[model samples]
Target: MTTFVSIGSLTGSIHPSLSGVLTKRKTVLNCPIHGDYEAEGIYLGSILKTQTKCPQCEEDQREAREAVEAVMRQEAIKKEVEERVAKSRVPLEYRTKSFDSFRVLNAEQGKALELSKRFVRGWEKAKAGGYGLLFLGSCGTGKTHLACSIVAALIANHQFLFPKYYRTSEIFSAVRKSYVPGSQTSEDEVLNYFSGIELLVIDEVGVQKGSDAERRILFSILDTRMTSNKPTILLSNLSAEGLCSLLGDRLYDRVRSKCVPALFVGQSMRKPATPDLFD
Candidate 1:
């Protein structure tokens, strides 16, 4: 038999009554959701406030991760662009010059091209030194053209060649600039830069009057690069003996010992406004 209890029978005692239906009116101390209901976790009830993560919080976390990834990608691209800019030093005059500019009218010109192609193909390995090139020849004979061509190939195809070009005058000027008041660059800084690059092209080795001071500067650059096992490409418009005299005995010995010799002898490829068609 089921016993039925009423308010008149048990006013101040426990009674058999159904659970009350919860409503929004009793949710004064309710959680953010499921008002006046039960929940799971510490202080488990919907009436008390909880510290659970909100939808907005989760979205924020995901956005933060994406932002970090974006920053990393930007930094990587920035580094690559900086490296490319540093490698590009070809003058506007020679910017468009390529292997196609040369006619290879003689064995020496062809040989220079073959060596350059090999260097470009093998640069990843050759950049660590042991093999370097010395392009000793007259101006307009395509020495600079061949050297610049290598730069073009690497820029177009290779990754991180980091080639640098400097006329012998510009090189010494950098060192001289350090002595000027308020200059940011130092001599050692310039030296470190030239010595540490992947491949350095020093052009016009004896373009002007060769003084003992100039020879000393050249000696320091060459000697440091040699010691560090960095390959260098040298361009000049002088004969071997003349260049040796300009470099002096000690520096020439160091240069000749490490570099493969190539003599570029040909009619000047430069078209006088009328062009030099004579071989």
Candidate 2:
């Protein structure tokens, strides 16, 4: 006699005798997708009867699970990027600035942002010939804002890079700390650490006077990273000529040879808190 599995009876309120019969030799199932198969099906609670789901159906379920996992992994990566961008800034002012909050009220600012975005998109290609970005202008022109926005965009979009940001003074401060006796961190170690980053951002390029030692340290950083095809971004309240004077030809030459320039000429973005200063 042909055997048939009453899926509803097996999955529904089970009689005591049904349980005894089920525990015996495996029951056979006839599914539309896989024809006949032997099953030692698990007792699913009142909600579902998957006795019809044969080995082929289980394979389909496995594929569905893998697809969901892939989507979850992508979301995790994006969340990590957002977190790192929030924490990357050294100055507190630009920490919260994002591309959305940045105002593009004029064409120059718009172009600056456009170029910054292009830099982020072509970053993988930069590792061969190297790419540098120089943001030059007076204070409050949003050069630093645009540069920070690039970092946020890059972290959100790319997986390989972890970038660092430093003001010109911070670069000196960081090196000075390494000079302390028994600190176990040498000056070369500090320079090498910054140089090895996938992207290095230095702000306020001409903010202070530079010494021969400072120049050597800075040159070592830019030269090492450039030869390895790493990218760097420099922000300043100075023009190209001003930076040339501030960093000197040896260092300035390296910057000029590799970097793309953006000039910002406007009133400071940092305004007085009083309303009258604006009006």
Candidate 3:
């Protein structure tokens, strides 16, 4: 014979120890479907155990889960709406111009823009999936404008999407100012915001000299996004060689792995246009 012990009893008359002994010897433990009903004396060691829902408990759990899911869905929708609004607010002139419109720009720049469009469109096809593109080129070559246009198209399609634009110098300075040895909450918040955005556009990369600590923050953000397969767009005057010079071999390698590197070649489009606008 084997000795067994019970834990507690539902009815006042039955001893908990006896209940445990019966449950241990006859009923199954940790059985979500049958354990509760079996303990109530509804099924006394029957070959086929019957399952009865605890109406109050079941309803409560169901309602709680529904409440959480409802809130999450609402938050997602709200975020999407906000992104659309922000993108819409960008000037029409900036958003309308695309790779095709810039006649002065070279074929490589046009190809780069097409690649970027494909990357963004691919993300829309898989909304839940995170992916990103990086545009590495000198200033005045329409990197920012193209990024904004892509965001505009996504918003126009009424997709749940958003683009977050940041200057590398701004990020570097903010991360540096927030550092106080152990306090990284501000830095974490920045990283969290960056990670959640559907697209991240970083302009003027290598514009600022980064300390070791600053580089660490940048690495953390990039690593987390890369691991999550989120899309990132980098706009810089630096070439691939220049990036290697600035960010070092290790970090440059990480960036190269995710990005389809493209060179933007042209006279500075930001310069005052000639009388004909194309000369």
Candidate whose TM-score is highest = 2
- Please list the C-alpha lDDT of all candidates, in the order they appear: 0.74, 0.77, 0.64
lDDT of 1 by residue, 224-268 (tens): 987777888899888999888887787788888777778899678
TM-scores, each model vs. reference: 0.65, 0.72, 0.58
Q: Which TM-score value belongs to model 3? A: 0.58
- Count backbone overlaps in model 2: 1
For candidate 2, the C-alpha RMSD (Å) to the true structure equals 7.8
Of the two candidates 2 and 3, the one with more favorable lDDT, higher being better, is 2
- How much lDDT does candidate 3 score? 0.64
Residue lDDT tens for model 3, 109-220: 7787787678656765434444455676766777777777666656645555556667777777666555767765676777677666666777777776756766776777
lDDT of 2 by residue, 1-279 (tens): 224444433535767545422222246777798788776544433223344448778988899999999999989987887778766763567766777787876777888888887887787776556887999988888898888888888877766667888887888888989989888899888988888887889988777677887777777888887777788898988888888887778778887778898888767778668868668
Q: Which sections of candidate 2 miss by over 4 Å?
A: 1-16, 19-78, 275-279
By lDDT, who's the top model here? 2
Q: Residue 80 in model 1: shift from native, Å? A: 9.7
Off by over 4 Å in 1: 1-87, 274-279
